[model samples]
Target chain A: MNPNRQKVLDATLQLLAQSGLSGAGLNDVIALSGASRGSLYHFFPDGKQQWVAEALQIYAEAFAEGCENAISKAPTVSQGIANVFLFAAKMMKARDFRSGCPVGAVVLDLDCDSEPMRVLCLSIMAQWQHRLAAHLTPLPEAKALALAKMIIACFEGAFMLARLERSTAPLTLAAEQMATLLEAQLATVSRSH
Target chain B: MNPNRQKVLDATLQLLAQSGLSGAGLNDVIALSGASRGSLYHFFPDGKQQWVAEALQIYAEAFAEGCENAISKAPTVSQGIANVFLFAAKMMKARDFRSGCPVGAVVLDLDCDSEPMRVLCLSIMAQWQHRLAAHLTPLPEAKALALAKMIIACFEGAFMLARLERSTAPLTLAAEQMATLLEAQLATVSRSH
Candidate 1:
């Protein structure tokens, strides 16, 4: 991405994180990025929709990278799941709870009508699920897939609740609960094997 | 609630559930309720903010009632917890993924500085936690409280993920996982006692 374009998308992400899709405006993005209107037009001539779509894509990549890192680097899948939750919690807190998963917020805003945006959101979620499933491949595929989906749901839901409640307890509890759930699943798999 | 006022709030809730707070305009509410502009103003003189607050309150009450019914009617605390998830899943599917918990959508659109809205959102969540805890009183108080928070978090998070992914699988999986988690906790409590 061009530095100027990247700057525009990054600013839009911050604005979207704070104000949501409808809350964010082109003027705000221009102001936040300190980029010229000409530059914004040069990059996204189609305007807000285009800018937002690109920003969502950027966030999707970053989020997927985080999941990849967690699974690849953590000593255990349970620890990796915990790390992912911690990372999300920290990001949300750092953004003062204004930032949630872009995929989640966008999906809520854009329905099937916006085919491109819908595809972007679904692709991100599917990729995240795939990554999580990969980590759980040692277990039964069905159980692992189900568990991965549940874990993702818990994390997403916790982010919204924790953000809405303006407290970290929900996220913290979710992490602890998830760790326990994953541990039990691992135990069951071990015993069966 | 006056019949007209109830009509207005119910319409607002329907609109909010379908399109979110920003997406639901006063005109939309009027159209949905089939109420004249004068009547809408007569009911909600302050326009969207006042209307949204009342709509949110109505949603909160209905949500609490749902929780209460689930808990009180179920055979056991574990079953109660599962009932809550099952009910939520049904509601989500019924809405075709358009409606999530009302508080979740409101909190997303509310300005963080809007103290009244923030309080209302917090109160609803606290009420949910309280209801869940009440059901689990037979267990250890701390454990009950912790589990309550975790369950609420999971439900809210699961709703978001399910809606975003436009799939009921996440919701179903989350409910099953939560039942497993709750059953395990209950067993531990039983063992300890």
Candidate 2:
């Protein structure tokens, strides 16, 4: 990727996380990325929509890859999920609760008029779910998919609460509950097998 | 309340849920509510911030009251939580999945520059958790509070996913998972007693 383009995308993603779509205006991107007006237009000719879409796609891919790596390294599904949650909590606390999942930001502030943007966000979300479910190979496909949905929902919800309260207690509590639920499912799977 | 004032407040809350703070501009409010600009100013003399805050406060109170009624009528904590989730899912579907929890919208689109707005949102969120926890008298106070937090997190998370996917599956799945967790905790309490 071109350095300037990469910088612009990074700035857009951060702004989206910290503030949402409205907050990631062209001016804000230029200010944060230090990319000149001419260059920014050169890289993203379609303007704000183009850049926000590209930035979110990049974020969704990286986020899914990191979550997959976390899941693959843990011995059990529960521990793997816990690792992901704990890492998210750490990042939230470090950012002073100013940031949350960028996909979530898009979903919350989604404009009903933009069909293409909405479809792109839906695909990004589906990709995240599919990637996470792939790591739960020991479970049946349907069960794994359900659990993945639950985990995603819990993570998004907990992150929002944690951010609002300026405390990670919500995220930590969510992690423990998810771990316990996954453990119970794993035990049932073992007994049935 | 006066009918015109009530109309404006309702319109503001819906716009907030469908869009965000930025989307709920004065023109949008006037267009949606059918209220004169003069009347809007008459009712909310302090402008956008005042009306948004007022609308959200009204929503929080109604939401808490409805949730409390759901919990009080249920046979157990798990069922009560399920009722809340199911009702939310129903509303989301009825609205064509365009709207979601107003507080979640505020949290996601929260402007880092505004301290009072952030604080107001936090109090609304805290009020929700407190109201939900108040009905779980069968359990110890600490445990009930923790469960309430989890329920809130799951609801917010699931609602966002469901809206993105254009389906209620995520909300239903979250309800089931929350019910299972609460039932397991209730079982432990019974055993200890």
Candidate 3:
């Protein structure tokens, strides 16, 4: 049961990264995961929506962890943001530009009226923003939050542009802008001292 | 006949803004447009893909025109970018946050394997970037293009974040960042002169 659940989640993420939520049919999910109808029904009685929530949750947690890890490990906050986007860019190129933000694909493709899914996507994105914000040391709380929101928006938007044009420039260019902003903020902190 | 064609395009854009490419089924298109099966095929002989292409073209051209109009009317390039986002923010809020970038929604939700669709999206985005770049009066060629691309990516990405979180903060924040960058660039150009 554990293996089946994990497999389903992983497959769902993969499918989402490639095509989107509505494009990811249930039959494809079951087929890709190799989970039987009986097991799927038993595990996900609420059906695909339940499975999707689980998958999104797992990915969202991992994304937050990644942000924390990236920030902690980097020498500077700007580099930290750059590292995250560069990693995403590399993954996208490796996938031949077929990959994108799973959260975004779901947000765009799913019915907008579905509050549960929207809330879930929003929370996941908020988790990422908060993780980034926590690392913007020396900046005011408001500034850090604003920068974090902009960074996430730019990077996620950059992913869409990158995948659309099949180029890494959009992501890398946004990262450069982010690094410059961080440097400017750091310089401000230094002047006060 | 002309009204029917216009209605179809309007409906297509509406649906794309709401649910994305795959989610906008043929029946929905027919049902929403109030156009008969005969008219849809008459207006779009190659079916939905062809219809999508037309809708996208109409959007892309209008998007480029908007950039031109915004930049030409604004007091400065930074203000131009801000005007675009502010207008978008108003529309998104008006739509209860259900509205999104039709190009972006399609890009994320559609199969990346579709070369035609990807090209269409890329072209549309490139047009916007180029339009912005052309207005960077004092900035050098390379810098102008880079700045324009980054601005476009950030603004476009901000829309996704805005819709997901159902707030205008991300869009407004990104626009603020763009304005700052533009101011900085202009200052640099002044110093050099």
Each prediction's whole-model lDDT (CA):
0.78, 0.89, 0.83
Per-model TM-score on C-alpha atoms: 0.94, 0.97, 0.95
* Residue clash pairs of candidate 2: none
Give model 2 RMSD, 1 decimal.
1.2
Q: Which model scores highest in TM-score?
A: 2
lDDT of 1 by residue, A31-126 (tens): 989999899999899988899988888887887787889868989888888888887788777877766665566656553367676676777777
Error of 3 at A157 (Å): 0.7
Error of 3 at A19 (Å): 0.6
For every model shown, the clashing-pair count is 1, 0, 1
Give the 10-residue window scoring lowest on summed lDDT in candidate 3 chain B: B109-118
Q: In model 3, which regions exceed 4 Å deviation?
A: none
The CAPRI category of model 3 is: medium
Question: What are the per-residue Cα lDDT tens digits for candidate 2 across A11-56?
Answer: 9999999999888998999999999999999999999999999999
| B19-117 per-residue lDDT for model 1 (tens digits) | 677756888888888888999999889988899888888888888897888878888777777777787878878878766766676666655567787
What value does the lDDT take at residue A10 in candidate 2?
Answer: 95
Off by over 4 Å in 2: none
- The A-chain TM-scores of all the candidates are 0.90, 0.96, 0.94
TM-score of the B chain in each candidate versus the native B chain:
0.92, 0.95, 0.94
Q: Please report the TM-score between candidate 1 and the true structure.
A: 0.94
